[model samples]
Target chain A: MESDRSHRASRRRFLGGVGAAVALLGSGRRAGAATPDPAITELPDWTRYLGEGVASRPYGRPSEFEAHVVRRNVAWLTASPESSVNFTPLHDLDGTITPNGLCFERHHSGVAEVDPAKHRLMVHGLVERPRVFTVADLKRFPGRANRVYFMECAANSGMEWRGAQLNGCQFTHGMVHNVMYTGVPLKAVLEACGLGPNASWLLAEGADAAAMTRSVPLAKALDDCLLAWAMNGEALRPEQGYPLRLVVPGWEGNMWIKWLRRIEVGDRPWHHREETAKYTDLMADGRARRFTFIMDAKSVVTNPSPQAPLVHKGTNLLSGLAWSGRGRVKRVDVTLDGGRNWRHARLDGPVLPLSLTRFYFPFNWNGRELLIQSRVIDETGYVQPTKQALRQVRGTSSIYHNNGIQTWHVHAGGETENVEIS
Target chain B: MSRFLSLAPALLVLVGVLALALPALGQTRGLGRPALPEEIKAWDIDLRPDGHGVPPGQGSVKEGEAIFLKQCAACHGEFGEGAGRWPVVAGRESLVNENPEKTVGSYWPHVTTVFDYVRRTMPFGNAQSLTDGEVYALTAFLLHMNDLVKEDFVLASDTIAAVALPNAGGFYDDDRETTEKHFWGTEPCMKNCKAEVTILNRARALDVTPDDKGAPKVE
Candidate 1:
């Protein structure tokens, strides 16, 4: 008890010292020569006292200092919040795997808070035997596998189709997240029900208010698809569809139906609203492209972006993320002077197929302006195209699948801004 | 002869065990029960483009206009022009323009999509609240507003597919493999790709992005 009182007294003294330093700095006086650095000289309150016990936070959360690291949404992007999207804070995150709570959310209606006890998944239509499995029943099934994959919304950089629109990377290229999913193979589940010989496509439906539906090819479902119930070693978050969700590997994120409730095998594709009216890409020649599922190779520099600008003058680390739907990212090329010159970035961690790969480039910054960019080459040997190259082929009419290289112009004063370089 | 006869019983036991395990391995683990027909019917609300799963109902444009004014007019404008940021459902603007207005009449390839999407999820919040007859009416009214149907025209499951949208021929299957694959070269440029880099556009100048203070308050 005596130690606790002394700790409180020391904290008060520390806070008072901080206030005095702030006042001295605010008065435009040079306090560095007159007073020593308190951060190094004086002991902090955290060091003097014992921290909280393990039981304090039953589950756990990021540090209070990291409260700013959160999912953010552009308010005017959609009509209502229920049917809108919130972006992942890529600039603030490190490593390849995204935290469960910080994953971007794109919902048609709203996040459905489903009760695991009452939730049921129905497999019907052209199957030999239509079956219904509850959440508990799904868990008991055999052949559960864990796999890491990246889910990128088809519209990750859609707003930039016209040009550089949003300032921050969070808004520009943040509609993606990488996570380890634990679930049963969709093929095993389909084989259990016995698929019909003529079944070609299957409609995966969600239980949200929108009843989101998308037709997925049967071939894709049989290979690499999963009925995932957990992500990042924990139960799926409510926004990510609790209890169960469909994981369509290497495909557009929209097809990964959340709050998954039904799978109906059919002979042909169901041209649902999502496939036709929305996800379809419109061309400048008055034509549209349907069933464009695969998200091509893309990369973006997270640090030194608009949100996280360069702050130091020397010995800084440039970090970014690269991913491809086709396969593993073979290499990531970084350019400090726009696209005039490029260098191979070092892939730091695990490089798995259909997963985000973290890369870093250490360089010395001498307070000069820079036009930074990164490009990715997937295992398929397909190189990421420039924005102009993409616009020439796709035109400015597309709202999805804009995997063009992004440029960040850093000012001499260490602030960065989103810009398009010619 | 005595040794051979003694081993026959052990071989028979092993064969019997194999026979029992093979069938179990071939079949499914058998975890869930068969879905009853009634349960399937309750949840099977999706509709295809060929009018396969559409329910039997009929509604006229006049009936749909009344339902739209009351339930949908608050968001979707009275004349289907759209209220606020809601989608405009009546426009037939040209797609080959700087800012094309992709409405039901301009971009939707098939009329069945109108009926299927409306029947499955419509009116935004109160989805699946509309009856089959109301859905048919609402679809007919939207078609009338888009000038695809006369004011007195009636819409039903049998006739829905015949009402072809104007952009029916404007859509094609994804051909990116041929159209855009050539752009992705085997070896990307490494040095001096551009003689000089010039800034063409800046996001800060547009200033349309939502600021930090205006973070979404979605529940």
Candidate 2:
């Protein structure tokens, strides 16, 4: 009886607070009579009507209001859609995990639609037993594991190497995505067919028309590699190599062959067109750097950026993403004055190895111009370098592996633009 | 003795269950069957720099020119100079320029890459449709266009390796750990990192970024 009395007292207090707010609104309206907010006074249509029943959409979709959140592509970036890329809308997302449908797509000859039953993964060359396994056969193998990893294209920030080119982070840094994958460890599969003594490298080939191929060291293949078929608790999307794909953790996205068809063990690397003509980092001295696999520590402020501008004047929350291919992110630093001073930003959510980490910094804005930036330090104590520092050594020619600090200039009127601070 | 006799029945049942489960676990270990030689041949198409997987075929520059015009010239241009935004396959621009034109003659290191790329994924949408001889012909024509071979040169599986291009020694293994690591100090500057900051460039000035309507803002 005493607890019920206290609850009634709290209810009365809440009602009194609402009545006082209305009375204040009435007194303020004496200057110029204003219409009351319909949203606050009248019930919305949903309150008076019955909504759709369960499973209206067999697979649930995002609310219609969120239709603008989507993958975007730069039409002039490449020649054709078949051999092009589309970026994830990073500014529209939250947390560390990128939704499966929103993951960035990089295609050589477009998405291949393969029937799982007819598709096969052939393991040959430098193996005791050359095996061909169907999709069902792979599932029966023991020691299945689920892991979250970020796959980044080597040329993620290629355009920004010279200067700030892309306005939105979606175009500048969206050639990446992180997802939880369910699959068997590659070590288990390779062990099933015993490796030959001479095996030191392996070639991963895709089943798409491009038949994309990349040679990987056997030591890495035996390490944290996976043969994944499911992502985010569902079967892989066709655009992301539906039946199966190779997951070379902590390496360039090109090494992760989609629609994986074959694995050939060898004693040396195959320098394909991707490794030679493309993906190589060209130096100012006219020499190119080959086999630069690991993506270094990098971070970017998603909010107060070009697309997502700071509108509120009193208080605001700044958020962004940071990650490293080598390991977990140890700390993230934010700068509001373009590197004059740095403050530690709170790293939120689980900081998994080779996965995206979310970070936030709360600040009170006073309607002043601000230059915003973020930097990440990985577990290995590697610090994200400044754009000038990277250019001092590597030059502006290299189109791949540009992990430099990005600066966003926020105006007093709440408009933000991508800028390079010197 | 009476207590031991009561537990014997339970122990016997446990032993029976282990015997039945052991074989099923063994079966799971060996999941896939051994692939036949024919199946390997159908998919093993990748080639190495040493010409390890080069198929036995030969094509002359004359024959290659015909195939290039009919099959590949629509996008690659009549003389492989690139049409519209397609890749220019024959030029050799300076590497240190503001915008380097890296073509087959200027950038590619291996001759086998030409053969492998064409056979595997060239003709854009109609990939792997070319016969092995036609791919060799296309490779020969590309070499001729790059001025690496004579018009009468014939590229065969055995002869392709002998042909070498410039910039073969232009690439080195990644040395960022040694060359660029010193720039990344353990303790980055927190206060007074720079005396003053000025905006050097703005993305809006270029106006090349795509608009929200998904159209190029080039105009």
Candidate 3:
């Protein structure tokens, strides 16, 4: 009886509030009619006219006001736009999946506009029977699979290894994107070539001006790699290797050659320019580490970062992205007092192996200073290391695969800046 | 008929599964036509470290210099010292120790990479346009600029493999699987993981980080 009475009382109170609001609006309109009215109470011009109807915008687009949400490139990072990278707008995005358009782009030469009709995939060298596959031929293969995976440049947070260099997470950690790929397993296609005993390596080459190529261990080629033609249920954008691209899960983005055209099976690694001269990690001891494929577990708090700072003091949702090339992210811990104390963050979305995962932690701020950070632990039980810990081994020279912890110093005035805590 | 034939295998497998009988191995489904010998030769441009696929060509250092100036000098500099932020193709003899300057001369293991990379992607705008002889000439020019070969040297397919890099022995296979094996531990410390912590540095101190134009307005 008491519960019913309380429910009735709440309904009556809500109705009373609505009645009072209507009365106030009526009185204000009547009073305004007597004076020179300045408010926008009259029907607008848009309401007076019939707007453009169905099929007006057959293809949808974001509102004109949201023009700022775009992939950005740093002017001084490279000599020209052709050989540079554009960072994804991670600060403007929520959830795990990155839209196909907003995904980061890294090109060695320039984006190739390939004609699918003319494009052909040649599988030759060290095979029982070499085969040539047109686009239609590739589509006819069985065991077509769709999977969501994250692709990260080995140099994602490389600049911050020396110190907290980039201000925003978009620049520091935005060289990564997660998307659902519709593709055929590379193993299935390689099987058609009839692998020989000496075929230990597979060289994937692109058709762009660069003709960018990388050698993959035959074991990895036959494991979980893919020849993807579509991303997020749409044909790949021209910038993203239109007809096809190699999707080597859990490996550096360079190995995932785009605009894929050929695959040559060989007995040994090619040790090409990308693997030797570029992607190799330089150590303090003067020795460089080559073929370091796996990207370790890493995480960064996207919000409460330099780009997305706290606007008000009260309830704030601390959200970020955590991922690992090895497997699914098992746990993410957020620290408020630097590294002294940490709280287990709630995993927000589906946690798939080798895919980006979102995590969130809600907290009420009293407008005090805070040093925010996040640490990720993957399925392999590998904990994300501190910047100091990584530097002890790498010594600040190794550029690629710097999965160190990131810190954001949040001030009492609702501003945050990238900082390093030792 | 083709659809029915494909479905017959699945139906047989289903019946075999219910009867606990081992299903017959399916035949390899061949879809595409056999690759022609000319098609294979056309796309097989990769040159291995052991000098397997180097085409029959000869290029002199004198001829290479002219090609370098015409084709590669814009990005790589006339003397291979590099222009602006492009790769410094020459010099940096002993700098890999202290503050490393990893140029082609100081680093890079095999010389086959130079030949393959130049032929596959060079002149920046127009790739795969260089003739085999021109690629040999460019390789010889880079070798001369690196102080490894004399000015009169002619680089050919047979002579390329013997030319070793200075830092050929300076590399090692990835040992992270063993070196960083200790990093994996299931139970990580949560509260009071460290006794004390201090802010050692800020990214803004160096004035390097880009301006946060997208920062939310502070109240």
Taking the tens digit of each residue's C-alpha lDDT, what string does model 2 give over A10-34? 3343234334433443354333437
- Those runs of model 2 whose alpha carbons end farther than 4 Å from true positions after fitting are A1-35, B1-28, B183-185, B207-219
Q: Which runs in model 3 stand beyond 4 Å of their true positions?
A: A1-52, B1-28, B95-99, B209-219
User: Which pairs of residues clash in candidate 1, taking residues 3 or more apart in a chain or in different chains?
Assistant: none
Residue B98 displacement in candidate 2 (angstroms): 1.9
Q: Pairing residues by index, what is the TM-score of model 3?
A: 0.87
Question: What is residue A283's positional error in candidate 2, in angstroms?
Answer: 0.8
Q: Per-residue CA lDDT of candidate 1, range A1-422, in tens?
A: 33335434533432343344334323543444577767779999999999999999998999997887889776566777888898999999999999999999999888999999889999999999899998777788768999999999998888888787776788889999999999998998898899998999999999999899999999999999999999999999999989899999999999999999999999999888898878888887978999999999999999978777776667899999999999999999999998899999999899999999999999999989999999999988889998999988878877889999999998876667789999
- Give lDDT for model 2: 0.85
- Tens-place lDDT per residue, model 2, B158-181, is 988778989889999989889977
Better of 1 and 3 by lDDT: 1
Each candidate's interface RMSD (Å, one decimal) is: 8.0, 10.6, 11.3
The regions of model 1 sitting more than 4 angstroms off are: A1-36, B1-26, B207-219
Which residue pairs come into collision in candidate 3?
Answer: none
For candidate 3, write residues A48-83 as lDDT tens digits: 999878888897788887786788766545657899
